[model samples]
Target: MAGYPQWHTASEQGPRARNADAVSAYAAAGAPGITFALADGVGDDPGAGRAAQTAAAAAARTPVADGPVTAILNAQQALRKLGGTGDAVLVVAMPFTGGYRIAWVGDARAYGWDGSMIRKLTEDHTMAEYFRTRRQPYSPRMEHVVTTSVRTTTAPEIGTTEVVGGGLLLTSDGVHKVLPPATIDGILADPSRAAATLVSTAIAMGGHDNATALFVEPPEVDVAAIVTEPFPTAA
Candidate 1:
């Protein structure tokens, strides 16, 4: 069997009274790849933490045979079944043959690190982003107002991207929002310690929200070898 890509995760409650972020990863059943999921609960909601936990677990465990987008949709359905005012933002990443696919909603983000620099892979689903994309001025408060969430009755507009090379990262807003891109790049410079460092540093830098990070190193061997069945081609 071939070795799979290495992965690590770290999460911290920071100064918040309660943590409302979740992270999960799982090997694809009967497939050659793995899936990573992260979710951030909407702090104002009473059931935010539970929603984040449910979304992250469901997204990570969903079969990747249908792709990361479908996995996120499945997670949304799971959140609906939970039936409450609970809401969360989510991001999912899955590696394929020579690249990987990422899907996200709200502000939980995906990033790629290529040793030299780190680049954001998913866009924030917030009013700030919407206004920025339209070249309109917006208040700073808009940044905190996400346009959609896991519990939306209507399907939210999900952000997705496919990329080649480099390591992958999934982060809750607590980490990314507190750290500058250059700071994040510097931490990722040491992939082995990236996850733990990211969470700790975010808290140190005055991040009061729960912080979470998941890092996946580029595969050292073909991911297909990890499974008994022939590797399925990514759609």
Candidate 2:
């Protein structure tokens, strides 16, 4: 079996009166990998913090054998069961043999850092991104408005991707929004303090919202062992 990847996470309420972000990571029981999940609650909702905590915990508990997409859908269901006026964006990453799988809803983001460059792995589900992709003009306010969230009445259109190589990063808008991509790349260059530095820097740079970051070093995969392992039986 392959060893679990090393990871670190940091979160701060920042300038916000309260924090509405949650993050979790653990070794997946059903697969030879680790699962990382994060949630950013909608600022306008009163129950946002609890909602984020619930969703992130639910997502992280999902077995990796089921895949990242299933992990996100499970989280959405969990939020609905909570039954409150709370909403949150979510991102889940699961690392496998040669690459990793990521799934997200709303604006929480995932990125790949290959030492020299940082690449965005998930697309924002915000109105601004929607307009930009369609080549339509939109107000700056649209940038903060997400089209869907974990508490939405309808199922969200989850964004997913698979990438090979490099380290992984997951962050709430508080971190990525305040810090430019170049600055993020610079912080990631040193993996030891990357997560803590990312959150602290965001706060120093006008943290109007909560900041959270989770960083994972690439796992050393034993490909031959993975190939020989027995498939998990149906539950």
Candidate 3:
């Protein structure tokens, strides 16, 4: 393994955002690789915000299971074990031996950047889409309102994806709803000032919700190799 995982994590309770709908994490020290998770609580439910916090921290504390798929399943199962009372979305990722495993549920998103291009790793699950299928008008609510989450009932339906060679970003809907894809790309590109800029922008944009972000940049593999390798065995 090479490149170290350096991250900038930050969150802010926005001006109009009543509840802190977001929770985040950076690379944990002396833990199972670099694991990060983020969650956005649905404001409609009273216990939703707390659910987000509980889910995010629980997910982060959990180790990477047999695989990404297993991890997602495990997280959903874990949330079910807890009294997850409201709708929420969670995103988790870790740098593995060969690549990275990224998984998500509900709407919180994961984004990846390979120096030039930034791509979204998760999709939104909402009834609005069903309405859209019927040629209905799109009605938007608080970005934190989610149709799916870790509730007290059934387990969460999750999604997973894999990526190699790039930096990763995780955020709640508050940030995505306020900024466009291009804007997110610009912010993540500047690793040095990305987190501060992101939180500031969300706050300035009338923060209608608690906005949080966890940006992870993988270090250069060659440099890590140079630092670790004992000797130049061959050319």
lDDT of 2 at 1: 31
Better of 1 and 3 by lDDT: 1
Global lDDT of model 3: 0.64
Cα-based lDDT at residue 120, candidate 1: 89
- Which is better, 2 or 3, measured by lDDT? 2
**Candidate 2 residue lDDT tens string, 101-155:** 8889899999998877789998899999999999999998898999878776244
- Model 3 per-residue lDDT tens digits across residues 1-235: 3445567777777754346355544333344455567877766455676667666766665555444444445555655676544556777776565456877777788888887667887777566654666787766752234555655223345677877777877877768778777887777778977877887797787757677787777555521122222211100
- Using lDDT as the measure, the top candidate is 1
lDDT, each prediction: 0.82, 0.81, 0.64
The count of residue-pair clashes in candidate 1 stands at 0
Number of clashing residue pairs, candidate 2: 0
Tell me the TM-score of each prediction against the true structure: 0.91, 0.89, 0.77
Shift of residue 59 alpha carbon in model 1, Å:
1.0
Q: Report the C-alpha lDDT of model 1 over 1-235, residue by residue, as the tens digit.
A: 3466877789998877788888877774576577788989998455998888888888877776777778778888888899887889999887676767888889999888887788888889999999999999999889889997777624447778977887888899899989999999889888889999999999999987889998888777655346634332210
* Stretches of candidate 2 exceeding 4 Å from the true structure: 28-30, 44-46, 153-156, 222-235
